[model samples]
Target chain A: MKLASATLMLSAARVEAERLGVIVCVSVVDAAGYPVAFLRMDGLALGCIDVCIKKARTAALFHMDSADFARVACPGGGAYSLELTNGGLTSFGGGLAVRDRNGVVVGGIGVSGASTEDDIAIGLVGLAALS
Target chain B: MKLASATLMLSAARVEAERLGVIVCVSVVDAAGYPVAFLRMDGLALGCIDVCIKKARTAALFHMDSADFARVACPGGGAYSLELTNGGLTSFGGGLAVRDRNGVVVGGIGVSGASTEDDIAIGLVGLAALS
Candidate 1:
């Protein structure tokens, strides 16, 4: 994905976090899990920095919402222990695959620093700005 | 620094890389050495991914260009072996500090995948876009 589009999505998530009165870290990664853009609200928890990046990477690498990956990564599931791969991944809510209009995966976005539901909501807001 | 500003700088470096016909990676890190933004041109070498980030982190952590840090990190210099600390650092050209109008350091930018001189030039273009 172009850097312009990546920044657009990142800004949208930041706006949503502001609207919800939450400070968060948001990360965008290309299809190969390389960073495209990232931003952390001032005063955010430092530990959330790596988590957000890993979340977006997980989505981009797996081509699935992190929550879905979470389900499949359970003890008896097909991808069990997969989160421990690819440098580390966050198989949970708040990370979603980014696809072009044709439904081809292009990148992924991840949000952190809020409740899991809130983080997912924020990520959705970012994805909605893709156009 | 604001995400808007970070993206602006990142775009400037990317534009420079395009003009030079070099597939490169660029990274921006805040004063605390946390990532603010990053971009890797399509088909860029994977090895440069971490190098660019480390270069930016070196500048941010030391408040000097990575080239200058290289001198200080030489065998008998005061900072010798410092690169092994703080995760890892790249003490070489292509990394420079980001400063505000007051000349206070705010962040840093790093570029990789080209000659050291070309990388530094690209990073300078990025820093020039800060205003």
Candidate 2:
């Protein structure tokens, strides 16, 4: 396992998203859910920025992706939650964890784009660039 | 004067959707954003459930749809701003208002699933069923 900069990883995700013809908002954060770097594409619907960040944070803190949280957390129910249905967290796929070279889960990356699968794939490839 | 059965309007909208091969989530609300009648199609994503509600709320409460609010709310903006991009309110095109026969603007409806245009179309047709 080698090491890479979180900042660099964040930018790489952005680049990859552009290459894929998808405009996305990407978030990189520590295991605690605090942001490392965040970026949202132009015309990316200003509303998506924070949602991506929060989902990334949720994934990092809970050590599970946002959808997983949404699965466990039903409407008006759960221990760890995807309560964003109230509007702050989007559990609609797209969020994933970012692990370091040591095989340790270092942080998480979340993306919002064309579709749920596209967002998740963008995050994985973006993190891969850092590795 | 005659009347529109709230339940009937809801059912008609669902029927129309079935004819179109689109499973949709529909929300009918009073002017206050409270549910007059709400229904989520089988297999509709759970996160989108509340999103339609609040977007309907935002459309009714502020007298504007979620997209309109997002246009005004900034990155970390204000009190009257559209704050849900952080996750609660989806400004994405699935929300609209429903006025009464008296033209008093009594309520609103929101639809989600498929594209933005499709979502809005479902809501409009749903509202039209009441007329």
Please give, for residues B9-75, the per-residue lDDT of candidate 2 as tens digits.
Answer: 5787677777778877777777655687778789888877777776666565444565665654433
lDDT of each: 0.83, 0.64
Which candidate should be chosen as best, given TM-score against the real structure?
1
Off by over 4 Å in 2: A1-4, A75-90, B1-87, B90-131
Top lDDT model:
1
**Which runs in model 1 stand beyond 4 Å of their true positions?**
B1-131
User: Which 10-residue span in candidate 2 chain B carries the lowest summed lDDT?
Assistant: B73-82
**Residue-wise C-alpha lDDT for candidate 1, range A59-109, written one tens digit per residue:** 999999987877766455576667566766675678899999999999899
TM-score of predicted model 1? 0.51
**Residues A42-120, model 2: lDDT tens digits:** 6464445665787687677666776676565543335433443333454445677777667667777888644566787
lDDT, residue B27, model 1:
94
User: Ten residues in a row with the worst lDDT in model 2 chain A?
Assistant: A79-88
Tens digits of per-residue lDDT for model 1 on B1-131?
A: 77888899999999999999998999999988899999999999899989999898888766789998798553334333344445567878999989899987788899999999999999999999987
